[model samples]
Target: MKIKIIKIVLFTLIFIIMLSCITKILQPKDDGAIYGVRTFFAQNNNHNSDILFIGSSHIHCSINPAILYKEYGISSFNLSSGSASFWSIYFYIKESMKYIKPRLIVVDMYTINQGAPYPPDFIFKRFAISMPLSLNKINAIRMEASKNVFHYYINPLVFYHERYSELNFIDFLLYKGRKNRYKYYKHYIPSVKVHLQNEPNIKSIYDVSKLYYKVEEYYLRIIKISKINDIPILFIVAPYVLSNEEQRRFNEAERIANEYNVPFINFNLNYGDYNLDFSKDFRDAGHLNDEGAAKFTRYLGKYLKENYDLPDRRGDPKYYSWEMNAKYHDKDIYNIELKQYTNLNEYMEKVKNADDYVIGITMLGNYQKNDRVLQSIATNFNIDNIYLKNASYVVDNNKLIYSSDGSNQYLFHKEIGSYTDLVIQNGQRLSINRRNYIKTKNGINIVIYDKFTEEIVDNIYLQKY
Candidate 1:
């Protein structure tokens, strides 16, 4: 009898160990800011965030907290998910309040018009997966799902069974420690691909007065939560080309903001003030690429400083993390900006002072004339035939020179981050490093960090140009 009891205990222990290993291996990888950073920040956050942002993917991709911290010195975190409804946003705020108190909440209005999809359990899973099982999460699932309560909440294993196929050594080894893909960007995923289209002033027939009651109720709840906590709320509409019908719907959001007496600003209406070039700055009709985000963020940062009582924490020691986050965030921006030079002379000069890199350049075929990608390059950069002259220009001491043996020739662009070797002419190749960012291809991975403080100054998963 004693031997049988001991055998049972040993069997249980081995089974538990195997299950633990499997869980680590099957955990999901970071897809983007919404998919990657929300949980990471929730798990590792120091609860030092002063500003809290909530909503859907628009909030995650548009509001760059690290950029805000760098310029305004206010620390923040983005608690957002893909296709998040007002219902989900309210619950996420509730979850955040359990851990930390923020001075203000910024709400993005992009998802306002769309009603929460029925059977809403799966949409909220991005957040549910990372958060510990708690009453806050339980209540959210109950409200969102309103069915399958047991399968959705009691057992996640059923939904996650398919993830076994996605498992890899990196998932278990975590060689670099719990991976935080967006740690460098402070949760802002920069978009670089440009599709030129202006916001059309088209008339469409969509009723704004008919917004679903559940949507309105959730917005009101968001307002109520802010009032209960006495946390000031601000509503914003990011830059996106909207139809007249969509614009009218956003007017409803404005109306609600006024009813609540909170500050509201629509960047779409004020885009001209920021010098936004629709042809150059947007990743698509709806989203602000990294370049557009920078302009809007800088403008908003200045406005917040002038209007709000945000403090600059640059010199404070307790908030040292903010500075480090800002450094990494800036590194991402520098990497993108470096690839955007429209002038060959300027581009070569910038590249010369920086570290060595490879640019995948391919010749343009017929019909390449209408290629908007090539046309977007400055008109001055055009040539009848790109192959006639070699682009082997290297920067030496901030000067451009043509070199044959260009094995080790890049050196300028001081303080740049990971790069996405965009096609300087038409067809170009790029490199992505272990950090999963665009750094120099097939070369030594170099990190430009603050050795003095042990903080990253730049990271290029490196962006592919």
Candidate 2:
């Protein structure tokens, strides 16, 4: 009887181990907003985060923790899930309490106008997956799921098991080598795409109206939770082109804030304070691009510092992660700005001094002898004979790694990150990981590949006439 009982226990342990491994392998690995937030939050052991930003996409895209730390030394985290309704956010706050003890909670009011009682399955599922297994998670799933709560979300494998076929080699490896990829992300994922918008002119309606009943209930619950924990909470409506209807809803949000004595700020009405340019700051009417987010975050950081009792964690060894995170965030900004340069001389100047990038250059067709800017760039790459029919060069960390002089047909291959192939035939052809980056047919073509991001930053051409 003793031997049989021991066998049963051993069998159960083996089965559980195997199940956990399969579940991890089957789960989708690339949802940054979902997985990144949960993983980073779990990793924050210092519990030094003084503020927490929660809400929909607005919170994640608009509030940059890196900039907050860099500018004001305010320790914070964007513990937000995209498209998450207040129902999920309430539980997110509850789950987060298990880890960090924050002094303030900032709620993004963008989803307050959403009329749905529960968020859509796609949004709910991501939020649910982002939460760790606990009593809070179980309760959240039960309330959020219409039915079959135990079957669908109790174990994510039911939904993700089919992804067994999608599993790649990286999935089996622990960490999946993504440690450095999002190190600077800090749960703040800003959109790099830009969309110009005409400045919106909308006035808040004076008539007081109530929020959607379910939204009001959850919002009140969030306020009550903060009060119970003795943590202050702030509500913000991040800047976006607003319509009359949306402004009315936001006005309702303000009324709630007033009633509860919670601090609230509507950025749509106060865009000028941040010098927000409608044409340049937004990725869309609904979201801010990187530039806009940085501006908004800087303003918000200053406000938090002046108005709140948040500490400056900069230069503190205990908050070294925040400093490192800011560095990585700056690298992301550098990558974005590098692609916007059109002047070859200015572009090369920035490139030549930066040792972190792997640079590739190929000269095609008759060199523009009269164009001094083009000639200067060629000389920088050690193209001694600009009069030569063709030349190709590769620079790693500002050192000449490879060069092909006077060769019309030169095939140069190197592993910048993964691999890069530069072939100068009739015209210069450059590709990174098989993605062609030939911007112009004939000119001095240069490609910048960032070693840190392991991706091509930009491709420029000094067109020769």
Q: Best candidate per lDDT, number?
A: 2
Point out the worst 10-residue segment of candidate 1 by lDDT.
Answer: 419-428
For residues 50-111, what per-residue lDDT tens digits would candidate 2 score against the true structure? Answer: 89888888887788889899889898878777788878888888888878778888999888
lDDT (Cα, 0-100) at 180 in candidate 1: 31
lDDT per residue for candidate 1 within 317-393, as digits (tens), equals 86766676676565555555666776645653443344333322222223234644333321322233322222222
What candidate 2 gets wrong by more than 4 Å, as runs, is 1-22, 29-32, 161-176, 198-204, 360-377, 382-392, 404-447, 459-465
**Cα RMSD for candidates in order:** 9.7, 4.0
What value does the lDDT take at residue 17 in candidate 1?
83
